[model samples]
Structure formats: structure tokens, C-alpha cells
Target: MISVSSISEFVYCPVKAFLNQTQKDNIQTREMIHGKLVREIRRGYEEITKQNMWSIKENIELEYIFSTIFEEVTPFIKKVSKKYSDKYEMDYSVLKDICNDLEDDLKLESQFLSLKVKKILNTTSKRGNEIAEMFFPQSLLEFPLKNEELNLRGKIDKIEVVNGVYYPVEVKTGMPPSKGVWLADALQIAAYVVLMDYELNKEVLVGFVDYIKICERRPVVVNSILHNKLFGVLDDMLTMFEKQEIPEFKLNKNKCEKCEYMDICEYYG
Candidate 1:
């Protein structure tokens, strides 16, 4: 069974997937630290948003909403700071400085949350609210897939129903809309769409890439072109997996510099 992440690894360089699956263990490099930090921040934001819904009440003011988000994120901010301290081997003083900087940044984040809430309320589409609501909803979080042989599964961040159309959202903490479409992310979202479609028996409208760092949301229309491409990638990966032929690394110099497997990569061209 191939995972969406495995498909992305194959796309990055089949050799990466080959080495990753075959190797007993791999060392963590600096690049992995950055990836971890980005993931932590993304989770922090999600928690903040989840807590906001509970704080809402009749005739609630915008300030109250902003405050609730801010307070909810305080513990998370401290937790992230402690994680950085432990992982980076930084002293307490350095950690304090970093936390202070993050606190200052939270002000801007509060404003961003306010804008998001206003935008959701003003828009005729209920997609944003539906997506937000899904985070804390127990029924939605329950695993929706049961077939094990299908070789694909993913938990969508949220699903939005807009004008009778369903769209899935995936959040990221990295720079908003980085260069080139990320094949891994595409496959991940595709897997979610496929699962949802299987359960609902309807075509999902689209998927969204929400980059919290840059405060931008990009739509990824999952048309037949994308669907075919994803399937082709998946089929190729499954065939390779069955054959047990480890692929050769096609190293790109720029990517290798930031890859976690750089130390062990034989083809660091």
C-alpha cells in the first residue's frame, strides 16, 4: 500500500523513497528542523481557530473574538518556544528573546484572524465557516475510510460545502504558494478528495492550499488533468514497489542543499 507521502517522495526523486523505505534509520539534519517548526506553527494556528468557535456568542464583538484567539494561542506560543529551545540547544535567554519576538508577531496574527472572520461572515459562501467548523466537530474527524487494499488514506483539514459543491482544504505553515506546485501536497489533497468522493458518490469541487505564514489561500482545481496525472504517478509508484527496484536519485543541487537525506545521498549532483 502506497501513501500520498510516498508518492510525493517518488516525485521528489524515486531514490529518496527507495532509500527511505529501505534504510533502517536516517539522521535528522538542519532542514528537518525547519520543517518541524513550520508544522508546529501550523498546528498552533489550527488550535487557535478551533478555540475561537467556542468563544463566540450572541452579539459578540470583534475585539472579543480577537482576544479569544490571542489567549488561546498563548500556551501554544510558549510550547513552540520551548520546543525550539530544546531542539536548537539554545539557552534560556535566547529562548526568551525568540519568544518575545514571536509575541510581537502575534499582534499581526490577531489582525489576520480578524480579517479572516470578517471575510467569512461577509461572503455569501458558507465554505469558510464550514471548514472552520469541521476542525472541532467529532463526527467529521472520525476516520472515513475502511478499505485497506486501496493503498491511500488522508485526513482532510476541513471540508467546505459551497453552493452545493464540496471542497477540501489543506493548511501549510510554509511560505504561501511556493515556486511550482508541490506534487506531494497535490497527491495528499487528491487522496482526500478520492476518499470523500468514494463515501459521498459525488465530485468534489476543488482543493485549497492555505499558507498561514503568508496569509494567502490558493485554489487547486482538481480537474481530470490533475486526476489523471495523480493516478499515473500512483500507478508507477505501486509498480516500482512491487518490483522492489530501488530507483536512482536524480539530484537537483538546489533541492539537495535543503534535503534531510543530503548526508547519505549518493547522487548529490
Candidate 2:
């Protein structure tokens, strides 16, 4: 099965997705490790916030909300940082330093989230409890979905149900572009919509890319244009996979500069 995420990877760099699947050895880099730790920390914060949402008073201050969430996530950072440090053979001290940096980053994220919460409550005509339920609709985290007909499968970061409609939400760890989402991200969301359609047996007209770094949700319309583009990429992905041949692509100096498969791609050349 072609993983949904590889669709985005392939869009970013054709060879990247190929190498990701073929490379069996587990190699860890500082950036990769740091990224993993950051994501874990953010997930911890999100889980805590969701768990405590209803319990929080409607009149709660944004700072109070942020502080509460941050406090709950503190131990999570330590636990995961230690786990990754040992597994990757990195110094625990270095990971601690990274965690220190993350403290600032996560603080900013929580603030953004808190502000969003406030905006929703203040602007909406519904009661505070109704606003809470609407803003944080019933959602499933890391929901597994698949389309056997398309031979595509992956987990949506969150599946939110609103007014009897299900929307797929893809959480992105990286910083978003200045304007809209990246092409890869948009396509990935469309791909998830396709999977949701298959799974739910109902047309999913929209999806979302949640840029967690800045706490922004960008909607993706699952229209014909996106469907055409998605199928085009799917064709290319399947062709490359079936032939077991690396497709020719101009090396992106910036991307290749930090790519884990640089050596392997160079070796192939």
C-alpha cells in the first residue's frame, strides 16, 4: 500500500519517497531527533488541553490556560526527551538543551491556541459551552484510514465531526509558508479526503492542514482540480514503485543539503 504521507514526500522530491521506503537501516540525525522530540511535546500539550477543555472556566484568562497546559506538558517533555536520547545515543544534556528551546516555542504555541479559544468564545453567538463544543468538535486523534481500491492508506492527525460531516485534519510540524499551505501539504490533505471518502462511503468535500507551529488551520477544498492533481501524482508514484527505478529530478541544493538520503542519492549517481 502507498502510504498517504509518501504522497507529500514524493511531491517534495520524487526520490525522497523512494529512498524512504527502500532504506531499511535506522539512521538518526540531530535535526530528525529534535523534530521528533518537538512533535512529541506538542502532542502532549494538545492532549492535555483537550482533556481539560471542558473543565476550564469560560472566563479563564489566556495566560492561565497557557500556563495550565504548559504545566501538564512539562513532565511529558522530560520523559520523551530521555527516551529519544537513549534510543538515538545522543547526550541527554543536548536533548535537555533542545527542550529548553522548545519551552519558548511551545509557550508561543499555547498562547496562540489560547487566543484562538478566546476569539471563538467572544465572537460566536452560542453559549460558552456550545462554543467550546463547536470549536473543539468531537475529534479522533491519529485516526487510521485506508482505501483498498486506491491502495492508499495513512492516519489523519485528527478527524473532526461537525454537523454530521467528517473533516480530515492533517497536523503539520513545520512552519507554514507565508500565505497558504505548501503544495505537498494541500495534496496530502486531498489524498486524505480521498481515503475518508472510501472509508465513510460519503464524499468528503473539505479537509484541513493544521500548521501547529503557528496554530493555523488552512482549509483544502477537495474539488476536481485537486482530485486531478492527486491522481496525477498517484500515477507517478505507482509507476516509480512498480519499476523500482528512481525518477530523475533536479537536486534541490537546500533540500538535499539537509536530506538524510543525500549520500545514497549521490551514490546512485
Candidate 3:
């Protein structure tokens, strides 16, 4: 099966994707390490959020919400910090610094969510369950989706059920674009949207990319154009994989400069 991540990587750079398919060794860097830390923390946060979402009261105060989020995520923060520290061979102090910074970030996110929830409560006649469904949305974390007909499969970061509709949410720890989502992200979400549509036997018109760094949620419409592009890339990727052929490099100096396979890529180019 063609993985959704491979589709995004192919969109980012076909050569890089092909190399990744062939190569097994992981080249970890500071950014990669930091990304792992953020992903682990976010995964735990989502699990806690899903569990506590139903218990939230409609008339809950913002401070209460903030404190609840903080308290719920505290043990997780320490646990993830300690685990990363030992695994990465880092000092506890350094992990503490990262945790402190994340605390501020999560606080900002909490404030943002609390305000949204409060606004919904004040403006709408919806009760606690409705409000929870609106924001938290009974999400499935790291949900695997597959479509045999399309020969594609992937694990979405989160699949949220809102108003009886399933929407794919892809969490991005890296920086997002200034406007809209990155093309690679949009394509990734589109692939999941297609998979979800097939799996649920419903037409899912939209999905979301959650940019964690900026706390921004950008919607990606699952339109004909997006589907066309996604399928085109998938076809090319499949052919390349089958033939074991190295795709011609489309030179982007910026991307290539930071790419781990840059030295090996020169041979093909």
C-alpha cells in the first residue's frame, strides 16, 4: 500500500521520497529530536483531551479550563521529558528547559481553546456534550485508514467526528505557511480525506492541518483539483516503486541543502 506520508514526501521532493523508500538509516538532527519531543507530548495531550472532553461542563470558567488542562498534562509532561532525556542522553536540565518552553506554548493553546469554548457557550444554546463535540470532536488518535480500491493507506494524526462527519486532522510540528497550508500538507490531508471517504462510505469534503507551532488550523478542501494532483503523484510514485527507478531530480537548492540525502542525490542528478 502507498502510505500517506510517502505521498507528502513525494510532493515535497520525488527524489527524496524515492531515496527514503530505499534507505533505512535515520539521520537524526537537533530539529528531528525536537520534533520527536513535540509529537510525543502532543500525542499524550490529545489522549488526555479526548478522555476529559466529555466531562467538561458548559458553564466552565476559563481559569478552570486552563488549570484543568495544565493539571491533566502535568504528569505527562514530566513523563515524556524524563523518557526523552534518558533516550536522547540529554541532561535533565535541558529537558526541563524544553518542558518549560512547551508549558508556555501549551498555555497559549489552552487559552485559545478556552476562549473558543467560552464563546461557543455564550453564543449558542448548545449544552456540554454539543460543545465538546464541536471542539474536541470525539477524536481517534493515530487512526489507521485504508482503501484497497485506491491501493493507499495511512495513519491520520487524528480523525474527528463533528456533527456526524469524519474529518481528518494532520498535526504538523514544523512551521506552517504564512497563508493557507503547505502544498505537501494539503496533499497529505487530501489523501486521508480520500481514505476516510472510502472507509466511511461518505463524501468527506474537507479536512484540516493542525499547525502546532502557531496553533493554527487550516482547512483543506477535498476538491477535484486536489484529488487529481494526489492521484497523479500516487501513480508516479507507484510506477517508480515498481520499476525501482530513481526519479529525475527537480532541483530546489533550499530543500536540497538541508536534505540528508544531498550527497547521494548528486550522483543521480
The candidate that wins on TM-score is: 2
Regions of candidate 1 where Cα sits further than 4 Å from its true position:
20-30, 33-37, 50-65, 83-106, 115-149, 160-166, 176-180, 199-202
Clashing pairs in 1: none
Candidate 2 residue-wise lDDT at 39: 70
lDDT (Cα atoms) of all candidates against the true structure: 0.64, 0.77, 0.78
lDDT of 1 by residue, 150-258 (tens): 6765556667665567777776655544553466777667777887778777587578776665656677777787788888887887778889976554558876776
lDDT of 2 by residue, 164-253 (tens): 888888888788999888989989989888887788775788888888667688988889998999999999999999999878887778
Question: Model 3: per-residue lDDT, tens digit, 1-269?
Answer: 77888887788788777766666246554545777788889878766754565566666787876666556787888898888888888767877888888878887877777787778767887765676666665778888889988888898888888778888889997788889998899999889888877887767888999988888899999899998998898899999999988687657878877665666765434
lDDT of 1 at 66: 74
In lDDT terms, which candidate is top?
A: 3
Cα TM-score per model: 0.70, 0.85, 0.82
- State in Å the error of residue 80, model 2: 1.8
Off by over 4 Å in 3: 24-33, 49-62, 88-97, 117-130, 257-269
Clashes of 2: 0
